[model samples]
Target: MALCLLSPGQGSQSPDMLARLAADPATAGTLATLAPLAGDEALRVAADPARCFANRHAQPLLCLYALAVGAALSAEGVEAALVAGYSVGELAAYGLAGALPAAAVLRAAAARAQAMDDCAPADSGMLAVRGVAIGEIEALAAAHGVDVAICNGDEHAVLAGPQCALDALATTLAAQRGAHVVSLPIGVPAHSRWLQPAVAPFAATLAALPWQRGALPVLAGVSAEPVRAPERAVETLSRQLAATIDWARVLDVAVEMGTTVFFEVGPGNALARMARERHPGLPARALADFASVAGAAAWLRRQLA
Candidate 1:
């Protein structure tokens, strides 16, 4: 079976997200290398509910968590045929694909978070809206001065802008029958033109990194195209910082590429859930759902067998 690895973004983080990885001896070395790169307070922030979701802490920690899990799965001989990530998780996807070293991915994630924090306007954030038509969401976003950040599906999208504007849009959508809106914990209006200022600097940061074609192809979030070359990877990685992400297309293209199994390496299982929801007949599971890396690997092996 061809396997696709899914990496989740910020909203998937939880207080105890790293506990399992930290306790696994198989991943001890990876955590040792990445935790320091993430920050002196990385573990502390991860364990603190209030601070963990902050972009500065969340980005690197989530990338580090995904890399550590990917490493452990690799050690078990579980290989991915393709990989994709949502938002900040895309950095981890590069590392998982071997385009960048794991440590570099953590460092890049830190720099990315810092750049976004520096460029993003204060009090700006994201909101997930579902059960509403995409056109209606776009119209509401235009009316409320927000931008559509991500298109998760035909009816599910995420909007980003000043918190006040997001609140206004949320208020408008709340009145619609069968509509659902939730304010994300993210502090930056990621994947919107509001973050355009972050694009060049982060591009330079990615360009400076040592890169190589990896064992598998990574689907670009911005275009849903397979990225195999380093130059293209850098371009898409940076451009995605300020462009809308077509995650719905990414999922569609993964299926079209013959992905028979979807496994999420993550701090949470949101990506896996999305995959299963979008392709119910496909086998999909998240590392977070298993008690151990071995268990997850075994399940993946079973699917492939």
Candidate 2:
């Protein structure tokens, strides 16, 4: 059997999310640790996903949710051969793969969030452009003074730019053939050169952090392959801020690495939807929005069985 792949990311969080999580004392306890990172009011704010998108709230919120799902899977004795993360979700993947303790992962997440927010000025923005060819999107970005923050697939690329540039780009995209754009709810532009100022300080913090040796193969978002050493992982994280995410290529490499079945472990069905559309026939499931604990656990167990 091939390994189960967990998709880590930030796009699908909501405030009513915890209401769906129910009263697992363990998960509740795990949720408690997020308070200090987000604030005593974190849980309340999480009831709406939009609130969590605030820079300070987003980092810790994503880390907490990722940890909650991973902890639940671990408690169920579920194991995968390899794991990978998208952007901020990489920290969660590292923790799940035993590359670092959960506490260390949380610290990294917090630091990363802070660094991005600190480095970004007040007027940058991100836009999700749908129905655009990769070539055309790149061309459009260049023509409009914007950067590709993430290449989700051939049709889906995120553009990051200052507000004025974003407005002009959106107008161009709307006028372009086969293009529609949606602005993202992010505090700062991510996965673009806009984050370059944050790279050095974030890297210095990561260098001081400790990482554990992993027992399972954990792949990289930058290289679309497994990382071999702790330092290598650190190096990737350092460059992450100033790099563009090649998600479609990453998915292809993951498929080649025996990820025949992908279970998106974060709060939204975003990755599952992406995989289904991208591959057409791949086996994929999104696990975070089930109606009940039994429903989710049963679904996962059935898949593994």
Candidate 3:
């Protein structure tokens, strides 16, 4: 039974995320490694709605969630034939794949957040637009001086630009057939051209780091294929910071690679939901879906059997 491991990016985090994980013995070791890296106010900020969305807090915390959950699953003897991630979650994916250590992954996530925050203009953000075709969304965003940052599927995309432009675009799309627009919690415009300045510095950071090709096949989010060599990790990680995300392709590639099941190893169920919707025949569940990592691990083992 081939399985795919998923790591979610930002916008999926909540206050109780860590607190819940802390209760699970299966995940304690993973959390212990992450707690110090997350800073003293990590748990407090997660519980504080106003502070959780701040890039500095959101990025590392989300990555920690992914790494911790993935670590727990590994500790329970579960393994994935393929691994993938969304945005900053990709850093955690590398850790899951054994390409980087958990500490290095968290540090890289912090740097990523800082770099993106520095380049992001004040009052700029991302918006989720459902029921609009990607092509149409791109056209509308271009007209509003924004960019289509994420293409989740044909009719779902995330647009990024200045707050004013996003508002204007949202208003225009609100009256369209089947259109539903919602402002995201993020303040920085991620995965858009606006973050291009962060690429070079992040590239240098990744390049300077030591890496190893792990046992599992890790898919590159941008290319939706195996990143076979450690040498390519730096370029792959850096370029995706400012490029558009093609998550639909990532799912398609997972199926092509013989993934019979999926485990979304992170805070929310968004990635699992999307996978099930796109490929109903395959079973997918988020780590949060179970009472504990032990429960999730046990269930997955049964499913494989």
Cα-based TM-score, every candidate:
0.97, 0.92, 0.96
What digit string (tens of lDDT, one per residue) describes model 2 on residues 1-305?
Answer: 45455656666677766555536654666666554554567678777655777876777677677777777766766667777777888767887777777777777887898999898878887888998788998998988888998888988988887878988888888885647888877758888888899989988887877777745666777667677488888888778778887777777877887776677777788877777777776777776657544466666667666
Clashing pairs in 3: none
Which window of 10 residues has the lowest lDDT sum in candidate 2? 17-26
Instruction: State which candidate, 1 or 2, has the greater lDDT.
Output: 1
Off by over 4 Å in 1: none
Compared with the true structure, what per-residue lDDT tens digits does model 1 show for residues 55-114? Answer: 999999899899999999999999988999999888899899988988789889999999
Indicate the residue-level lDDT of 94 in model 2. 81
Model 2: CA > 4 A from native: 22-26, 33-39, 48-50
- What's the number of clashes in each of the models? 0, 6, 0
TM-score ranking from best candidate downward: 1, 3, 2
By TM-score, the better pick of 1 and 2 is 1
How far off is residue 294 in model 2, in Å? 3.6
Candidate 3 per-residue lDDT over residues 59-153, each given as its tens digit? 88988888888888888889888898988888888988888887888788888888898898899999999887888888888989998887889
Location of the lowest summed lDDT over 10 successive residues in candidate 1: 25-34
Candidate 3: what lDDT? 0.86
